[model samples]
Target: MHAPRATSNPFVGLHHADTPLLLPNAWDHASALAMAGQGFRAIGTTSLAVAAAVGLPDGASATRDETLRLALLLGSQQFLLSVDAENGFSEDPDEVAEFARQLAAVGAVGINLEDGMGAVDRHAAKIAAVKSAVPGLFVNARTDTYWLGEHDETETLSRLDVYQQAGADGVFVPGLASAREIGALVARLDVPLNILYSPVGPAVPHLADLGVSRISFGSFLYRRSLGAALEAVVEIREGRRPGGRAPTYEDIQSLGADPARHD
Candidate 1:
């Protein structure tokens, strides 16, 4: 069954909250439900995890079907969902918008579209098409200026300006970590500014202090889960207990019992 639509879009308000929205990126149904069970109000799909789960390369637009399948499975759940659709799986503006429309129809409230350092006008066109196709979908326009290569302050501001004008609900800079620069961007952006959380950089409170509207843990949790599982098996082989929390089989079984779980 499809999830019933909420009376209003709650995702937009999340960015404007007193405290920044801490978005946990989940890979599969169990992980998403597990996070929702922990009182997270929203969950995002990590494209890396999604592609890696199916043995496909990320950022190559190879996980469109996998991404949609996961969305179909988790979209009916209680929490809001924002999918990390890498470049919308197409460079064509209309195609990207159609993909976003499909995502919105399945109950996703937001979509993260990265430019991948492509043409500024082309990415802006995709964003504009998406806004036109699904007006309610929160378009988190991402610019990979720092992610792909050296950080150019001028290019960053210019791309973000075009995206904002293209009707992006928010803007994301994934590799950005400088506090002063982040503060400067926050001071200039008219819409919400989303910063990908870096462990070596500023802490969550520090980002919030800098006026970041949303902080995303992109692929961090998924990678940690993999590391934890590998460590657990190695520890068992060495006749030692695992150092981290391992959910019981029954606990995992409980995750699928309800779409919305309460403490």
Candidate 2:
């Protein structure tokens, strides 16, 4: 984080359309900074990772305070920041609008708002209100149709159309592991299309060719880190070596670790 200055919100709007924005979702300040150090121009905050860290339910509107605090902590980092604000944490359009303003003040250039399989009009209105409140903030409206991808994929496109009409700068569809579906969605959407990276699916270059404008690594890193730490501790208790690459003390110092949420 650094002092506020007048600069273009580089991550805002459809700028990611050219080379594709590979956004890694950081749960805390250290992770955000680590990614920035790796030359990532933008980063996203994962609500699932943040909520789980604070023992709150993800996508349940239970982590509004925690989410805001995390934004305050990492908003001024070098990388452009976008937040995964689950359903705006409220159904009311006005309430969501006010939340958007707070996020903008905290220095987030973009936000990912999910529909949560809720009403089409309801999520669309939230997008509208947020754009009105924080016009500079890029709104990547997400639809869970293909995410949960239970039925036909065409239904996902229909949902995105509503979000586009409501003024989303981009759209995200997770759980769309199929190349055919991804290509079709990219061809149809007027705005940038973001797809979550799948380890078992197409690689990054392949995805880029399919016309994906952004690829987000959601809570994958956070969850994997947790799993590694737990495994290491168990191995140590049993007098066995750990199973992964452990960072040196110097690296930890570089990350500026505290007792909570060390990167």
Candidate 3:
């Protein structure tokens, strides 16, 4: 296995400053390298994109191997890579911790673990196990309370408290768009608060003002890429060139070129 490239992980320091880390989610190595080329410091894998790409169900613990393979592929890229291992792909905390260790061995700097509204204690156990096994891996504990159902500030805070106590480096609450609630949560947490960026919700500047330390475009880029491809096909079918400029074939292929050759 390739050793982690960075002697000191910059992914952790990205959360310490005032500027919120704008993390773009990538589905594959090419997508990740493309984002890295555009100057993103770090990239996260979107479980939805990964599962859909492989014709598996997301949040069902079905894409464990695929997720690991993607992590192995992207972990050594120029940019820091964070794998979204939904529920750690297992109910057993030990298994989750082992998986995290494997990811760290492959050069991943972070892992995103979601609760999916399961038992809070169980999720916290997994977080503790992962941290115990790989303390350097940034464990961004995610709660699906808002995404999966109604927003309960009390329950959200309760869960986040548990996760923070369990040693989560960051807390992610996706589908949470309310500026007031976000600020409230930010004030309540000791660690960085990660909010998923919604086009219809608060803008990036507004989120930074709300004290959000990280903004994740979770699965948005992947979905938008699919939309763009479909629109391009339809435009061709209707006898018109696509509106936006696309990457040249050579440029796209260059994303997969051996990095050492460039050096």
Candidate 4:
């Protein structure tokens, strides 16, 4: 298995207004390989999928090992892999820095670190530590201000300001889904802006037009895949073929051996 070229902070910054990063959220190696074959330059792991599949909880920082293992697997493949380390799995900056180091050692190119509605100063410190530990890893600093119902613009700006000053390459807003707000944020920030994709929310093209540099699917694809699998099982029980253009078993075998190959 050939490893992909190591990524830098500029790799994430390359995605921009006219060409936003269409990041596909992967649950495991096979899915990630499939999307990589389909021409996605970078792949992001979904925390919800990793947690749910292992029967553990999601976003409470219960999947550190799982996240690392997945990153190790994808790192050998021919694409940039970004691990979602929710809240850095601890409030302590040292632990988060260690986690970032593990990911960088395994060939991961980027990491998603979230505030998780924690203290802004603490999260900023964590981001700084992660950067100190893994200088090449693209740190996408996430703020959950809108998701947590404290949508105070002043406070949100203050938190992001701290993160950017602390050396975050990009900032992510998971639940922000407005063109006006997004435009304002993009115009104000010096670093790249990442927006989470919502099915009912703004589309990728719309987000690109609004000046978003990166668009993350988060857990949307993972949940949608689960929904699709359940629906397929029900359809089979009803004496009908399942939906989706699935690959054959042999195709999957080939992917296991070499993920970069589509056929």
Candidate 5:
């Protein structure tokens, strides 16, 4: 088999901009291509959507094959792509490194690995191994202290420090919405700080002002899309029109056509 072609690596530079990079997460090709058609330079995969589509649980190390397949399909596309490989799908650091290599080989420019508040040493070792295996792949190290109910600021900082030392290109802290805390984390990290965008939390401009380099809508879009579909069905059943403009059949079909001419 031929080696994976090198991607242009535009994601890292996106962090240094005056404004924070707004990364929308997609579940499949249609979502990804549609986002890219709208001129989004970078798109990330939502692991929850991927696992749900296949009747599996997210963050349970069950969607490794599905994740790899999605990466292979999206990584070779026109835009920069990142895969959300939750905890690298294995406890073994070497297995995680191998998974990173496979993702990189398929043209993925970045990978998001979450610790799920597990052993810090194991997660750090995985990060180090992935970096060693694929130096070019942007490893976004994620800690779930806030999401998993451990809101200890000291623990969060300690894990981030270990991951950064292990060669993470960026640090992601989901469930962190306070601007003061976000600013403090950004100030403490040498690498770019990725914050999960919360609708009720700080706005994009506010986050940019707080020195957040990257903002991600993790699974929020996917969940909202499903909710919208259900709402539309309810409206139709009640003999009422759905609220928002729906995409036409042709418009939906066009996403699979010549992506180069999408715009």
Candidate 6:
């Protein structure tokens, strides 16, 4: 088996770099290679995109096999890969750990597991199991209180504390847009804080200033790509020129060639 690349293992270290790590989440081999071409050393897979591609529902544990298949396909690539396995595809901690083991064996350096506002202990068990199964894998334990519309600061803090204590390399809070709230969480958390980047939320630099260790563009790029394609077809039908830069056929084909190195 090929050894996991040095670039892949230092994914957690990227979180501690001078600036917050800006992770561009990709949906497929082409999107991943395209982002790597643009100089993103570490790329994450978006679960929503993975599920949508297979006509399955996201966050419903309906795409475990598809998610793993994507990971296996991208694991050998040059960029550091982080797989967003929604809820680890099962409620059983052992099953989640087994899945994480597979991801790591294939070359993924990190795994993002979300709580989805489930029981804190169950999520913690999954996190701990993953840590024990693959100690080197960076488990990004995510709490969706904000994304789920709970917005309970007390509950958020409580859940994060348990996740971190259970051995999450970092904690991700999606849908957290307030600078004050973000800063407060940053101050309180011991591990790296990963914030999902929202278009209307604080910009990258502001997030860095807020002490965010990582910023993930989760599903935004995938959604935008679809939106852009729709806009292009509509424009063509309306007898107007498409606005954005679309790559030539050859340019796209090149994405499947030799993967670009971070160096």
Candidate 5 structure quality by residue, lDDT tens digits, 210-242: 988889999999999999999999999999998
Candidate 2 lDDT over residue span 4-110, tens digit each: 12236677433445566789999988888777778888889999899999898898999999989989988876668899999999999999989989999998888
Deviating ranges (above 4 Å) for candidate 3: 1-8
Q: Backbone clashes per model, in order?
A: 0, 0, 0, 0, 0, 0
Q: List the residue pairs that clash in candidate 5.
A: none
The runs of at least 3 residues in candidate 1 whose Cα sits more than 4 Å from the true structure, single-residue gaps closed, are 1-7, 260-263
lDDT of 6 by residue, 1-263 (tens): 11222334688778888888899999999999889888899999999999999899999999999988989989998889999999999999999999999999999999999999999999999999999999999999999999995798889999999998999988999999999999999989888999999989999999998899999999999999999999999999999999999999988988777655323
TM-scores for every candidate against the unseen true structure: 0.95, 0.91, 0.96, 0.92, 0.95, 0.95
Evaluate all candidate structures by whole-model CA lDDT and list the values in order. 0.92, 0.84, 0.91, 0.85, 0.90, 0.91
Off by over 4 Å in 6: 1-8, 260-263
Task: Return the TM-score for candidate 3, rounded to 2 decimals.
Answer: 0.96
TM-score of 1: 0.95
Per-residue CA lDDT of candidate 3, range 115-211, in tens?
Answer: 9999999999999999899988999999998999589999999999999999898999999999999989988888889999999999999998888
> Which pairs, if any, clash in model 4?
none
Give model 5's TM-score versus the native structure.
Answer: 0.95
lDDT string, candidate 1, 44-138, tens digits = 99999999999999999999999999999888888999999999999999999999999999999999999999999999999999999998899
**Superior candidate under TM-score, 1 versus 4:** 1
Supply candidate 1's per-residue lDDT for 215: 97
Candidate whose lDDT is highest: 1
- Which residue pairs collide in model 2, if any? none
lDDT of model 5, residue 238: 100
